[model samples]
Target: MDVNTRHVLIAGGGYVGMYAAFRLQKSLRKEIRRGEVTITVVEPRSYMTYQPFLPEAAAGNLEPRHVVVPLRRVLPDVQVITGRVVGIDHAEHTARIDPRDGAAYDVHYDELVVALGSVARTLPIPGLAERAIGFKQVEEAIQLRNHVLDRLDVAESTTNEETRRRALSFVFVGGGYAGVEALAELEDMARYACRYYRNFRAEDMRWVLVEAAGRILPEVGEDMGRYTVERLRKRHIDVKLNTMLESCVDGHVELSDGTRLDSDTIVWTAGVKANPVLAESDLPRDDKGRLPTEPDLRVVGAEHVWAAGDCAAVPDLTGPPNAVCSPSAQHAVRQAKVLGDNVARALKGRLLQNYEHKHVGSVASLGLHKGVAQVYGIKLRGWPAWFMHRTYHVSRMPTLNRKVRIVADWTLGLFFPREIVSLGSLQRPREEFERSALPRQFSPPASRSPELESAHAGGRPEQDGK
Candidate 1:
């Protein structure tokens, strides 16, 4: 092993990957500048999403771009590859990189960081793959915002009772932070947007939150969870506990308790499982497809390899016996700092430290000026809780630049109102261009030239059958 040269290849530029690499490059600046050490990060997207703000982003409280930190911009000293690591051969220290185009290539490394993070945990319910949307990324968040507002557009225009009902109905599965926050924020936004619509009213829109478990936000303990339920119910948001989505075939949602709903917007935030890419890796993984890692964030029984974030089953030192860390943002960011430091310590043959942090309580924002939180055993709800939620998350928004921008957005929102434009066309940006790109001979009748329109309508004198 050459001590003079080292290359660290980090897979999945999420919380763990980006932070770990950033730490390495920053800590080993001289080594990197001397060309003795190198760091490379490969991920599908070029940014790391500060997921906590995604709800606000979706609800128009925050801009979509502010939620994501550009991996290349943040980790300027490190190499950032925009691609996917399809396979990892830890023993050989090579990972198969699949770019957007061209053949898959291999990148050799001195150390491997498996930080692929988690993917949406989807069930095999009918129509789930097609109709159900996720709330994991900024793209999905904004898409949901556009989609929910578009549904409002659909409901306001259609006179068909069934169509209007379906368009106005929204069903959200799962009741964790993601599910609750997204449902609350979007419902608030939609209700606010309705003040401008003639046919829209708070009573007309039906919002339902379904949770398979008997309680929602189980992390916040039973009492706070109940309070959350009560608050939601008061807002006319139906909170259904002990229920499962049995089937959702063709927008007809069937609950386990035999309830049915016709909902055009079905957002799925049930849970998250380990990234499936770990299945292709040569590293040791648990039955749940997560890397089995020690408290030090090193993968068990694997040399030159480490893992963290949602994809690693890191032993919880601060919890009870035989306990493991829960896959939460709190743990991911903290574990990342330790993971990076431990990796740096390893290069210098120094002793490694175990990652341990007591589980602080949780915080969740229901909507603007509304939230619930349990911090340091003290329970808080409504405005103070919402304030804490925003404060904590903004302070943890990675770079100071993003934090400032987010605060600016909130400050601006204080005096001004949120823009409720759908921008659904942003999804299909080429539609107008594509329409114009069509030749006159191939254009639609309404958009065709006058002569072409007459010809297309069979009104030409030569084509007349008289």
Candidate 2:
């Protein structure tokens, strides 16, 4: 180990952690070649999931593999640890690394980057955890896709009306970008999938979206939001506004508006809070459990520490005082670039630039050729918004390889019909292995077994031989 060398430790590999590492690795290439600085990224998953494309992936519009950026492939120069940074002790300049296997150990670092990201902000509604699926990662998206298709199968096969009705009913909680896009795309896919079913029609299936707020997708203007609601309603999709999910006990969904329905699928996408592991440290955090960062992406009053993305509350310079950046992918990718540059500047003893970016508006897709967007104060709906949504995300997606692959997927979708098969077994990849690992049960010789059985049954062992 070089005594003069500096180690940069990152706590995640999502938008912020991955892109920040890329920037630092590229900017500090010379320092890294000379072994003067080392960058290590600790993340539970080895790949970074491009969340915006998850809805499409779930709808079979894009391959799931293309939606994730392999951290090792993208950041070859940086040390990628496939584990988690469970604890951070900035006082000693050390972080506790809990690897995928073995015991947790501490790793020393000269600089620390907290880009741990966020987790689903869920409520304590009855049976929520047991029934609801969250659409945060690629696996969850894949699982949800399979689950929905499997529900259709159950509906077609079931003899009882109640059972079939429950199987056909799909409920999505929270009307934010995730819930809305996921529900719409999946519904479109499922509706089209009905072409193969013998007994079910798309109209027979009930798709419901429950939102607690007055409007959904507050990211765009109220008009665009209402228009989105109208589009969904026109599709015969139930869009419940100003309604709360009171309870979902045993698949019975009870709403605040006194509406009740039985649904097998319940997706939770209400919101996300900062990663909870940030609270384990003595580091300063805001009320929302996020690191309060300066305009330069530095953790407030914390030495050699920088934070960004959903995990950090970076002050929004373009907004009024006390306003922090939103936890959107747009902000996160931009923040990572600036944060990485500032980190490099700090290490090289140069002037650090403050991280600042104005909100560039938002875009969301409803279904294929259907969307709503407000970019630069100009509004778009239907196909244009859908195209813009895809264009922006593909351009923002990290690495040229992934960008090309995603585009290729889109090209394929144009020529081929959407895939409707469900691979739910992908969720339990280890099930087959576990079944194989079971101890073998071999029968002893018949005479030997019979002697033991006869003895236990009050007959002599010699009698069995006779």
Candidate 3:
């Protein structure tokens, strides 16, 4: 790389980072080919995962691989580094990065874009750390599928009613889009699986939603949120609003509302907090630990440093002074485009434009052919909303190839039933193999008494008196 070349370093490879990098590569193609500008992306993962399709991945509607876009393949000209950017020295114009498996190095950059995404926010409640599972990653989706199946197997094999009841009860905490959609999709899958087993029935299992707030799906407003609660209740799901999980010790879940329920699985999906890396930087930040950026998306105090996505608190022009953009993909994806354009403009000494966008409503899938959506002040429910949810996200999914594959999955679903095979034993495959390899230790080896052996050889057994 030449000293005269404009070097841009993007801190993340998520929805914002990856998309922004792609735009940068395309916009600066001639400049990069002539050694006028260079782009480097530093992220822990090499692929960008589209999180909107995660619920369908959990429900077995779409393959997990289709949701991730490979950064190298998409941005052929840009340099993609698999590492973690730990800190930044803005005054020195250097970024501290810890490579995937090596020592730290200082990457010199003319401009920086901080797109580090948020992490799952957790509470300090007892037993939550050990008992609760999160729905953030693709791994969690796979694990939850196995767990649900494992519970089904336990319920199918056991004769103890108490054990069976506890095994069948599933509790989900938080009522946000993630929490509600995950619970709804998984419940739909589990209910469909009961037909294969003799002892299991849809009514036998309990699906409970525990939210600290009085309503669910706050994005859809009060009326629709209430409607969602009522619809779920009609399906025999126990919706406990304004209830907190006091404890979930070893399979027993106790609530603040005096209801004690025993369950095998607990999922936590309250909300998310920005990644903690922002605190180490010299850049200005808001009260919520988010980088303070100008309306043009440049970091306020740092030269050539820009921030967007969940890590940056971009001002909401449509809202009050204290309000910032909500940390969602809708904002991140759009803001990233503007951020990338401004980055290129900064290199050429052009004027940067301010980023002002209004909230485009939200949509969420709630199981098969069921959903809730609010877009441009219009509210929709049932199949129409679900169709809109799928259509909108599918359009936004990474590439055309992935969009085709996802649509194919939905098209196939119309003709065929879902595959609900619970591979719970997958988590403990080693234990299963060990049990098969080793002999039982509780009983002695088989042996033959002389009299029994003789009787088997056609001789009569001898009496003690004889």
Candidate 4:
């Protein structure tokens, strides 16, 4: 609260927030030592997830812990607060925060950095929220792995043909990199897992990918996308293009093309929208509900306020006029550094630079050894593309510790097969213990609810009472 000291409060601990804090701390190390400036980062999570490695983690290619960088460890000089920013009054230069375990409080800041990233852009489809899983966080990726492996276990143990069929059927919506990589990696894992089951064969399992768009992996160009579709089809995986998921009620998937299938697993990775926290603040936002920023990442029409990452609509100076940077890690990482340097420059009363980066390319991993990439206009596929995908992500992943761990996982994977163990109970660790503690007579009735009954019976509820 000293008059000479400046408090810089960052609203998120995502890619942009973390990197900006890192840059600011490094750039203003002298000021920080002199007690002239302080940096505080407020976010819900203690760690920043490297989302590109999520699919591989889910498929047991990398450990879950290695995919996340602890903010405190990474930003030792900066104050890391595990909390959510509920409201921000830029006019007053005050931010209201709700700490994870404490009461809400307001903190005044000389400068504000809005870097709260995006959230899953979901729809109002019946049973979608309850049944379908997303592929965003480390937890979701881990849960999907367990759920998929558990489904295979259920199919192997069950004699009912319909039940087995449903358990073996996996449906993924969306054709973006997230959806494609997740589906491909998981399918590969499941296929390898079949070797352990005497009754289950890779052929018996169904992998269905439904995309509302005309093609999948649009970032890799039309030819590569078409090739991806062909490769998937060759593996007997159902690739439905120009298709929409009508409903997923009770795991009964209905497509726009009038096809119905029973699937136990539904992974949704359609799209993402800017974090809704922007609306709570008095910041100027664009039509897409994103904070509008100048070429230099400073908030348009606001003083001492800057924005970047998926939450900010940063103009793409390297692209055509009126164009904006795409919401990808490539842009986010670059934008963060520029945004940080600009903040430091503003503090020192120096000139600011604009954020301008040309579109490099995109890479998508399909299964273990299959991938597609279009880097700097050069196209690649198969093993070369897959190697590029891993190398690119590992290099970008924060910290050398995490990089080494992930590389170690891959190295070990080469010697041993992918582990297909299902640890679904980790999602609800206390469930069995709580149930066991209950007296036999006082136990909940088996017929009380279909969901409870299914849990007790270790089977899914029958459709229409079968």
Once fitted onto the true fold, the runs of candidate 1 whose alpha carbons sit more than 4 angstroms away are 1-4, 439-466
Per-residue CA lDDT of model 3 for 37-154, tens digit only, reads: 9999998988888887788888888887888888999999999999999998888888899999979999999889999988888889888999999997777888998898889989
Please give, for residues 1-466, the per-residue lDDT of candidate 1 as tens digits: 2566799989999999998998888778888888888899999999999899999999999999999999989898988888999998887889999987789999999989999999999999999998999999999998999999999999899889899899999999999999999999999999999998887687899999999999999888899999999999999999999999988889999999889989989999999999988999888988899899988999999998999999999999988987899999999999998999899899878999999999999999999999999999999999999999999999888889998999999999999998899989999999999999887764474656777766768877354565
TM-score for predicted model 2 compared with the true structure: 0.92
TM-score of each: 0.93, 0.92, 0.91, 0.93
Per-residue lDDT of 388 in model 3? 96
Candidate 3 global CA lDDT score? 0.88
**What's the distance in Å from true for residue 190, model 2?**
0.6
Between candidates 2 and 4, the one scoring higher on TM-score is 4
lDDT, ranked from best to worst:
2, 4, 1, 3
lDDT scores in order: 0.92, 0.94, 0.88, 0.93
**Candidate 1: which pairs clash?**
none
Candidate 2: list runs displaced more than 4 Å.
Answer: 429-466
- Cα error, residue 130 of model 1, in Å, equals 1.1
